[model samples]
Target: MSSARTTPGASHHEDAVGTAADGSGLLTYASLVDGKNVPSDQWVYVVDSDALLQDAFSSLTLKRKLESGRLSPEELPGGSIVGRVARADRETVLQAVEAASRATVEWNAFPLDERLDRFGALLHRRLTEQADRTIEILLREGHPLALARWQVSGALECFSPESLAFYRSQMLHESRHGERRISVRRRPDGVVCLNPPQNAPLSSALLGVTSLMAGNSLVVRAPRSAPLGVMYVLHEIVAPVLEELGAPGGTLNVVCGDPAPMLSAWLDSPLVDDIMYFGSSEAGIRFQERCVAAGKKPILELAGNDTVVVWKDADLEYAAEALTESFYGSGQLCMIPNQVLVHPDVVDRLTALLAEKAADVRGGSVRQEDVLLTPVLRNEKFFACLEDALSSGAELVCGGHAIQDDGTRDTAGIFLEPTVVLVRGLEGARKVQAVRHETFFPLLPVIAAEPAPDAVLLDRFVDFVNSNPYGLRNSVWAGDPEVVEHFVTRITQGGLLKVNDSHIGFLPGLPTHGGTGLTGGVYGEANYPVLRTSHIQGVSISDGGIRPREAVFGAWQAMRGEDGTAAAGA
Candidate 1:
């Protein structure tokens, strides 16, 4: 369903509205609001369910429909909806953002409890009722089922009081000099914008949650590729709560079209205080450069080349199980393992074990499942590296097939099979290192080594993975305690560290979301989402009378409440 946002009140434009689904067949193209199939007549913009909720339903037409509680059956779209978002020029975005900037005063006046309670309800419903649709829409929009579900569902956990209460920790007052001592407090940055990628479109667009919960207005840059999930997830979920919670209207806005104009506008304007970007390291750096030039703070989570190492004392079964994490989603996850380093003693044994269990390592279209992997449709560049490895004498122990020339959605279901290439010796090892680059397909390059020859081989391998420029998640399968301790201490590299388990084990609330190095600027962790988006306000409160007080205490005499342990001197 398409909802018109611009108006002197809502009016209709009838110009033989025709739309196509990303150049795909027309029959499959459906819009959610009106439930109308995109007319096979002319080309138009297509949005998935989530975007329907965010941009469409939340638009003037659908918002009135939902508010009036009279969604017409004739207007209900069939598959999904394709709507028109007039590709606005920079002035449009600036105007809308300035309008929101003016609205922040009233938006910030709402009590935190009431506001959170509203979003909290929406968050709960998101997890409980609409989660399945959220999953289906994400998968339909071209993301792995498990990965998509986790991306959408996991972020839902942020709705509860416990989830965002930490945001208010420093915002509240503490006791000190008989004046209800308020140490530090944080305020919204007025307006914050988010531009998210298409891979996890549903989850990424919600990066606006940072601004929303922090009392700042959020204007999201929704990816045009799969705008459905982002919109619908918001309308069917967040909108109702935001309304009931009494958030000022226009505080949460969405612009659904080419992000180029919108992003450029946001960067050039003084209205936007922060810009959160999620995508390639290259794009992020360039965007950040622009933001810096325009004097705006940009929070980015970019590309990662994670690694997984199997030790001599590792469990073959467990290491094999981790193949799901490294190879699944075609290794598109930022935290997914990019390289698998094997110790010499377990090299042959583990390869054989993997070959036997390789049936579990499968790939197909996003619509299909039990299908553990996806063909790396964009893997031609990586192939040159693979071919160079082969020419340099790397042996192909497993898969080598590439997707066919004319790959349709149906044909693209299965791309390259899970490949295992073993480099000749330590001489060719550099050719297969993830430390150098990343490959987003199910082609695993195994770097073989004989840990039996030296006691430090395992330690050295761990160090190599840790010392790499990328710092996502890296797993090591081993049963040795001393080795675990050594790694746990020395490996301060990846955001998530795994021992004797899969890289996706601590997922959902896991700290594997962000990394540093060429990967991005600031390291990221999911649990620290709120803090990452807001500026810190540290206030030191004492009973007062500094001039009368002769000396200052060197240590804090208090401890954090229910946050686990005490600060060093507390």
Candidate 2:
């Protein structure tokens, strides 16, 4: 499954296209519109970041693009020219929406059970079979093998039997009310438009398929920076499943191009009911307002400044390992831990363990199975946050330098070393930018509060966690059940809470994404794509043909027992 290759240090190319490991031509993808691979005059060339870092390409056009600030190697994943894709225009975007609107008529009418068996079951099976290819594409796009595996696994878990069953129950259920049938059901929200994030686009796009289980037709905008993996998922994996189920053409449409124009088109389209958007909180909140103004539902997957609390009695080794997860993909992902709140008593020991662990998290080529670091082209923000933390009385515990692919320090290095800083007092924690916001780099802030009684300390921690404006996932590491219970019941923020568990790991029955506050915008909550992309309605039916007046005044009628005469009991 690995597409590992060796290339010369310098090579010339007319365009961004390279041979595969077996010497076959690189894959080319087209925008999927109305169930067809639609081509365009324009193209977005995808370069493998790893290849760029290795100096595999020295084309004059590439150099000029870089010199002119048009291309950033940090944005790409692997070293060679991975693939190229067509760029969509306004007409293509409109066509996609129309196709989705037309398909929903047939799609939304299918029985939930049938939809699950055909789409859900079949998707899981196909992804499992093609898991290797999926991971390979992800790796080529810059995700480390381990992170890629986790993404693939998380996507598969969403379609697991247990997950499907839970969704089934939520979509519709019935109950008997003596002579009547009372029911509650979820209806598709018509055509849905999804804009997956540049980071981890493929897996995010795959997970978006859950909306279809709720009977909604979809139009996905593959991120222009990383579209191949997403294009493959939709055009290859999902399209085939929809076809096998005899789904209508346009049941699923995909396009790749600029976001602003496509988003404007979606906002203007009457056919688009819900837009599943992923981005920073500032941008997402603004977009949410726009979506509402346009009379469309905004399903946001925004920024996360997740916190990990380590109680004094926690397994320090295990907790340290979990905290290290923040460095995965250089902490570019939203769900990874952003800050650590450790008990004053255990703060020193935990920081020591973290420092030791951080030393082993090396930055290198993305093709290496063990490497997690990717290029950080815009590291100025990372350094700014670090400076803010240092100025706010925080001490750098380990790593505050840029590391090269060869594990050496250089100011011009493309990777930010896994850095940790310790802030002494919780009261002043947020004064540090790294503590207050999502740095999106491999910098972790460990804060310890002034010593206090267990109950008082627990209360303060809960208050601090709730005060966060962003709410994605919050986690606690504690051995005491009572302490865990206190944190769980008192903490009033975040979408998911983990106690003595992996902070960013996924489970079949749990939501892989979502949050409250800024993380999800005005209506944000733990997102289940199936539920988020649908609406609910209550229903009641009676074959007894009860009179409308009698039904409306049933309680009074029962008391009178008919003919204006009370029953024997009455």
Which has the greatest lDDT? 2
Q: Which pairs of residues have clashing backbones in candidate 2?
A: 48-78, 49-77, 49-78, 50-78, 50-79, 51-78, 51-79, 77-141, 77-142
At residue 415, candidate 2 shows an lDDT of: 80
Instruction: Locate the minimum summed-lDDT window of 10 residues in model 2.
Output: 1-10
lDDT of 1 by residue, 1-570 (tens): 233222111222231112223332221222211111112221224444333323343433552452244753235455344343223345445655775686678777877665554565566665576667667656655565667766765566545455555555644545554432545556666777778776666666554564576567777665666566665554445555566665655666655557777788888788888888777877777887888789887777777777787777888887877755666766666667777788787788877777666645655445544655644545665567678667767777766666431222233333565667776444446655432677766667777864445467856776677677777677778788887777677777766787887676444334436666656555344324445556656576556555433334322223532445576555
True-vs-predicted CA distance for residue 60, candidate 1, Å: 30
User: Residue-wise lDDT of candidate 2 within 450-544, one digit each (tens)?
Assistant: 99998899999999999999999999999998998999998979899999989989998799899999899899999999999999999999996
Off by over 4 Å in 1: 1-44, 47-91, 109-118, 157-182, 365-367, 375-379, 403-414, 424-428, 433-435, 450-455, 505-509, 522-527, 540-570
- lDDT score, residue 430, model 2? 91
lDDT, candidate 2, at 417: 90
State every prediction's TM-score relative to the real structure: 0.76, 0.92
Q: Positional deviation of 253 in candidate 1, in angstroms?
A: 1.3
lDDT for model 2, on a 0 to 1 scale?
0.84
What TM value does model 1 have? Answer: 0.76
